[model samples]
Structures are given as structure tokens and as C-alpha cells.
Target: MDEQSTRFETNAGVVAQIRQLPVGVVLASGPFNYPLNECYTTFIPALITGNTVIVRIPRNGAAPHFPTLELFKKHFPSGSISILSGSGREIMTPLMEDGRIDFLAFIGRSSSANALVKYHPAVHRLHTILQMDAKDCAIVLKDSDVEFAAAQCVTGAFSFNGQRCTALKMIWVHESIAPQFVQKVCEIVDAFKVGMPWEEGVQITPVCESGKPAELKDLLEDAIKHGAHILNAQGGRFSKSLASPTVIGPISQHAKLWTHEQFGPIMPITSFSDLSEPLDWLAQNHFGLQSAVFGYDPQELATVVDTMAFQVGRVNVNAPDKRGPDTLPFGGKKDSGMGVMNAKEAVREFTLETVIATTVNDPRNVKALQGLEGVSRVVKGTAGIKSE
Candidate 1:
């Protein structure tokens, strides 16, 4: 991914030539979140690397409008890229168990990921790429632009009803600016629009699935019980039932929302006297996807980058929930997922590396190799005594 080595490399008088050889047939399947664009993360890259792709479109609860499927059908050849449509387990299990499907790329819940790999261990030996849950952290420093940072946090936390894995679920503000920052966040929350997505350009839609709203509700209640103050829509700290685009004040360590990945517009803010406190807190969470830090000092920001270099997949500076260009490697660490799905990385993931070598130790000018093994021999005139 760093482009350090792609074509050839030589070290210690040994030349190692590499080629990208595609995996025979790949099965790319996932949920409807970013349904079209996310599928391309795996499908297109696999295709570009010469692997035939079979995409399984989500056909159940909250299944998105598959415009890409139609586009594929109209233009591409029948067998070049196949599209499968059906309910979840019934259709997926058979394809997963099939031996011919060499590579698997899945995006869904952690439990479903286990089902895909665990059940068909004997048959499905391929290492599956998974993109699952995350509750990302947003660190706001005292020197940072508080209002700008809060605006970015609001968009990141509430957009898509906060369903995105990169959404800012937890916000850690410097203790010096905690009061002002919380007040501003509540002001924006009050102005947030909540209704049907198609009506009046509503900002906060319902949770993608049926049960998720209730789950978010329960988590909010638990956070409140644990001493987190919920800021009502009018920018007042009045205890009430939680709903869409609700903002919560600084919570303790024991709050459920602090740990759980809430797939709805529930924003939780915390204050820290020292930066290391929140950084350590973030490290313990098994799900490491993406995080953001807001600060003006270049040295401090560089330190943050250095600390999070291997901690998360990507780090956003002042921008909130900003996914870079399609060419950028978009992925997560640990429980968040495995392997990046950008064009270059996906191509690498779907393709196998092959090595070709030669040895000058052989006395004979030409030697016989395995008849059936597919190794070839070619001759050429050389001026030097050894084939160096």
C-alpha cells in the first residue's frame, strides 16, 4: 500500500520478481450500508486484478436501492460479473460452503462474520475480509477552533443517522473549553431536523432497521442513569426520553454508550484534564476504525498522528467523518475489519504473489524440470561466465 514494493525487489544477491495473480473466483457479499459504493471496494478491485467477482446484494431488512446492479446487468457480459439476490442465511450459506468460491469479502455484524467463517471451516478455507462495528473517538483540544470542531462533530455524529462506522460516537473535549463546547453542540442539536428522509431535507432519519432505535434508546437511558446529563433540544439540561439527534453531556467511564457502538444519532461528549486519559481509554476499545483530533499546533497534531499511526485505519484532522477519495485505502483495525478495500489494496488482497528464481550453481547448461509442474525453461546468449 505504501508502494514500497510492487514489481521487483533484489537483496543479498537474490532477485525476487513479483506478479499480481488473481484469485480464481471471488464472492463479495455485504449489507446495504453504502450498498453500491461499498461493494465496489471489493468487487471492482477484484475485477481489475482479473478475478471474476460474484456480488450478493442484500435483499432483506433495510436493503438499499441497488441501482448499480441494474447498471451492471445492462452493460457487462452475463458471466463476467454475476449478481445473486435472496434472503441472508439461506442464500449465503450454500455459496460460502461451495469449494469453488476461492475468496470471500463480507461486510456485516460481528456475529454474522463468525457464522460465515466458523460454520464452513472445512470447505471455506479462504481468509474472509470483514468490515464490522466501530464507535469512533473525536478529540478536541483547548487551542482548537471549538465552534468549527463542534460543527464537524455534529455532522459526523448525526449524518446517516450515525450509522456510519466512521461516525463520531464519542467526543473528548479539553476541560478548559468543555462548557462552551457542550453549549455549542446543544445549540446545533436544537436546530437539527428530524423526520422522513424525503421530507423537508430532514437531517435525522430513523435508524436503518426496526430494533436499532430501541437499542439506542436503552443505551441512552443507561448513560443517563450512570450520571451523564442529556441536553434537551432547547439547549437545556432537562432529563427526558432520548430520540434522534440527542446530545449528551460529559459521561463517566461506566456509561454503556461510551463502549457500545450506537448505530443511531446519539452523541456522547466527555471531558478530560489530560490528553493521555482519553487516548488510553480509546486504546482499550477492541473496535478501532477511525478517529479525529482537532488542534492548531502542528507539533501536537503530529504527535497525535504518530500515536494513532497503527492504532486506527485512518485519522481525520479537523474534518469530521470525511472519507477520502476512492483511491485512498479505507479500512479499520482489530474488530473493525480485516484488509483494506481501496483499489490498490483490494487488488493486492485478491491477487496472489508469485516468485521466479534462477540459480547459476547448476553445471549443465540446461536441466529438466518437473514435466507436469508448469515451470518453463528459456535460453539466451550471455557474455559473462556466470549468469549474474
Candidate 2:
């Protein structure tokens, strides 16, 4: 935390503010995809800021409760933290409506975020932060090492069974080698192990079916029915412990799957005639959480870095999907989310600012007759007491 704050001061000017008053409460809500992380991200920072925290675990019960509680209890005072399991939004609403909670942070979807904004009490002192939905992309180039790109893209798209908001959902490939790239990527994906998390050799595990996988499959099926290609992961079997990671190819720019955040092991690939095609595709999308690029061209990398549509928490260059460190702020750009999470951003979100000014020297003790040196002397300059 100290190292992060030090970097923040050099980059974002956080140390000056923290040196000032820093006591507040932070209310954190956990997201189902990364339950343990979401809970820890908010809870630790709030506790560090000398503020109490109340965390609500997701309704589906996918939290690392004992480990998290144990870690906090070791360092924090009794009653400084409370992890309540069950009922996410229902439990959160009361805290948002209360002034006792100085800061409120949530990690979920856009719909849930809108609900909080609508239901929250109109108190100016209460600060709210959201790390919600995102539909991320993987831009594949023509000159890229086909096999390496496929492996990287597979890991990026299905490592957490595509449950991460930062996972690659849409893949944009250059039309010059789109067919070859698709074939190679599909072949790699087909061989990925999908089974129990504790299995000897498994790369992807099933998302606890709180209904997300079924909905995502329906979307993929709809895409296929309407002219897209579906490349089923060949070696995987669908069971309670494993999810069938499917790849939908040659997707259109306007497909619903391109715009929505599919929280499952499903990959959708679209071909672009030129670089602008993918950049334009990004411009129209609603969510921007993270993006990965598999290319050798420096120009393309520069273009993505400079584009407004590339706005996201982290940008992966030729690497698989992974948020770098707790030091970097993680969140989305568009309807994907607002505010930030983890590292310095989370700490800033948990605290409030207050400015104080004071005036000394009694009015009666002042010399009223002093000239311009000590006090103001009015001249009859038509504009009344216009002092020099």
C-alpha cells in the first residue's frame, strides 16, 4: 500500500491529500465473478483509512469468507469489519441510503449500478464508486505468430471461464488472414481442458450456474442461427464441474454479443477489412473494461493507445488477459462502469475531503486610520471607498 501510494504521488498526487485528514467508512459489495477479490479490494483499503466496512457477499454464495475474515480479523479491531452473506442489492440499499456510510463501492453489472443510483438517498456527503460490466476485446493482427496468438487468446478468453470482466469477449482480426487465424484459434481452444478446478489438467472450470451460462449459450446459439459460425471446444464435456467453452466466428459488427458482456467461456471473433474497422467497432460499443492486442506493428499499437475508443482500466499488449497489479486502478470506461477499484484508486474512493480556513487578528485591535501601508484609505473617487 505504501509503495502504491508513493507511485501515486509521483503520478497522480495522492500523498498530499492523504497527509491531510483521513478517517471514513467504506461500504463494499462483492461481485460473483471475482468474489474474494472484490470483497478484499474494498474492505482492506477502507480499513487502512481508519474507516469501518460492511461487505455484502453475492446472493449465489461464491465468496471466500473464512480466509478473508481471518486476514482482516488478525489486523483490524473487533467490529471494524462485518461480512454478511446473502442478498446483494437488498442488503446494500439500506447502507447506501444511510449517511453513516461515507463511501459506497459496488462491483456487479450496469443494471445493478442503475438500481443503486436510483434508490440511493440524495446526500451530498455520500460518495459512490462502481466497478461493473464490461465487454472487452482482443485485436489480432495479420503478421502475428498464429500459434502463440491462439494460446494467448485462449488463456485470455477462457482462463477464468470468461467470467472476468477483464476477459476477452470479442476478437477482431485482420481480414487478410482471418480464415487461418480463426482455424488456428479454434484448434487451440478445442484442446483446452475444461473440468473440475482441482483436476490434474484443467484450464477452465464451469461458472457456478446462477443462470449466466445458459443465457450466454442462448446468445451464442442465436448468433449462429443468424449466420455466425460456432466452433465447439472439441475435447470438453459439459458436466457440473466443467463448461463447454465455445467459439463463435465471423461475427458482425452489429451482433448483440459484440455489445453485451458475456460472462461465460464463449469467444466471438469478427474480421476487419482495415484497422479503422475495429476502431470504429469499438467506438459504437457500450462497455470498455480491458483490451488485448496480438500484433507486431508499432503503428497499430500507437493507434490503439491514442484512440478514444480504447479507454479502459488496463490495455494488454501481446500478452494474455490479466490485470497487472493491485497498484493500478481497475474499472471500465463507458456504460461498463464508473469510479475505480483496487490499489490507490480504491483508497482515494474510500476517503472524503474537507477544507478549513481561518482568519486571525481582532477587528477592534486593527488601526482603522492607517494609510495604504497598514490598512485601506478610501479616496472620494466617485466610486465611493475605492482603496489603493
Best by TM-score: 1
Q: How many backbone overlaps does candidate 2 show?
A: 0
Residue pairs with clashing backbones, model 2: none
Candidate 1: list runs displaced more than 4 Å.
Answer: 1-17, 60-78, 122-125, 234-243, 356-388
**Which tens-of-lDDT digit does each residue in 199-317 have in candidate 2?**
98887777886566568766876777667877664622345545588888767545668677777888888888788887777777787777878888888778875673357667778
Q: What is each predicted model's overall lDDT from 0 to 1?
A: 0.74, 0.69
The C-alpha local distance difference test score for the whole of candidate 1 amounts to: 0.74
Predicted structure 1, TM vs. truth: 0.83
lDDT of 2: 0.69
